[model samples]
Target: MTAPHHDLRQLQRQAGELDVRLAAARHTATSADQLVTAVVTGQGKLVDLRIDDRALYGANAQKLGLGIVEAVRNARNAARASSLPELNALFGLQPPPPVAGTAPPLPPAPLSPPPQARESVQRQAEPDDESFEEFDFLTDEEPESGGGRW
Candidate 1:
């Protein structure tokens, strides 16, 4: 194959460096109620959480948990949104246009061997002959029927 163009190589190098920087970037957000805060990396990992003491005392456990989850989601969303344009441009990504009132087509099913051919292959791999029957280890005398150990 022909060598890549110098300009293309340069672009790829720049994209790689940008990817490293983006992965290290972090975004933070507080919950709507101002009771929870979360920090998330651009890669969508939650790195830190801070919950106000008032949140624990004033709200039910479930309500406080929900607030924390919401804060993390908001932080991740902000992080992703900030990098989306640059990442898309660097990778030359163009999302498909939306199709109105119709669901996206399903992926095609995987191809498979015919059932008869599959069975034939399995049968060929198995040894049907009783060659092992030549051995007679069960010919030993029967155990004594007495209750006491022999």
Candidate 2:
């Protein structure tokens, strides 16, 4: 006899919905004085930049760029805390994934900054990683759709 009907298509639909929602998320970060801010999409893409009037008075490219990045990243962290309850439940702050049959992902070294932002604050002065504890995604394997989706 044929197997009972059990199409996996429903699982695929759920996976699509999860990815769509993730792609639409946005995070924010701020300067200590709230003078500068940047919004970064969930995918770590810079989305918007906001600067207070005071920030513009004597803004240097280096400082301004740094503030924007920091602010956006800060916001992103906060968003993660508020949003991915399910991911946290599953991963519990585990690091990135690993090869199919290998150990988990190793802690990666910092890479070069984007060419456009040559004068990046992070590039100029290597800040202590402890200072920015926002990037929750990197700290853990953010969950996507269950494998059954595929």
Candidate 3:
């Protein structure tokens, strides 16, 4: 019916608008000490980075690196937080309720294979003793015959 067609058209239009918004979205964040600043897109791709000259003074690579990482992480978190509402709307999901006095949950640690499985894999990957036959080509004996002339 006409209603279904209208709904599809509306959805297409909303998608186009969301695409434009996402493309134009940019979030900026600075490190706690204000030594590093980072700008990221809606998808958390770093677009710009700025570091204070003081941050590099005395060649403190570790401090500078940490500042850069913090700024970039903050920028990415900002981008995600800003875009989450629209994403939830598009997906028809309710925003999770905030818990007081609780920090955001950390991502789960990566799973590793059990020791038995790892040992099995290692055993399977090992080459057998009989798999290769040694060939000795350094014998002092000369050829028995020269069948063809040069």
Candidate 4:
């Protein structure tokens, strides 16, 4: 077989390095007013959260709540983004803005084995002798005593 390309090996190495970085770090993000801070870790853990008391002021309570939600999601996005170089290199793509909802692609399933040969191989693998015993209901009938429960 021909030797694999050097570029492929380099990409693999870059991906490995990126994976290591991703495993050890986290990301933090806050809303526009700095009222909330959200932290997310490499293994998808939400490590810490902080919200300013002023965030709940008067008419802005709803906006503050929305900001908090946005902060948390953005924090996770940042973490995923931090690891994107590795992911892109690994997948041989330019890269994408990683997000919390995005799941890594799963490997494709292998092709099915040929049906006729598969059946033949299965038949050969099975034992030649087969069991066909059946139980009879009266095989162990006991002599009844009319005096007691039957």
TM-score of each: 0.53, 0.44, 0.54, 0.46
What does the lDDT read for residue 62 in candidate 1?
36
lDDT of 4 by residue, 23-112 (tens): 677777776678888888764468888989887775455466667777777777676656655466467676554553344522322234
- Highest-TM-score candidate: 3
Better of 1 and 4 by lDDT: 1
- Against the reference, the lDDT scores of all candidates come to 0.65, 0.52, 0.67, 0.62
Better of 1 and 2 by lDDT: 1
Full-model lDDT, candidate 1? 0.65
Q: Candidate 3 clashing pairs?
A: none
What residue pairs are clashing in model 1?
none
**Pairs clashing in candidate 2?**
28-75, 29-71, 29-75, 30-71
Provide the lDDT at 40 for model 3: 89
Indicate whether candidate 1 or candidate 3 has the larger lDDT.
3
lDDT winner: 3
lDDT of 2: 0.52
Decoy 4 TM-score against native: 0.46
Instruction: For candidate 3, give the lDDT of residue 114.
Output: 83
Better candidate by TM-score, 3 or 4:
3
- Candidate 1 lDDT, tens digit per residue, 13-124? 9788876876787778877788899998777789999988888663344367668877887777776666666666666785422431122222322234688987777677
* Candidate 4 Cα RMSD after full superposition onto the native fold (Å): 20.4
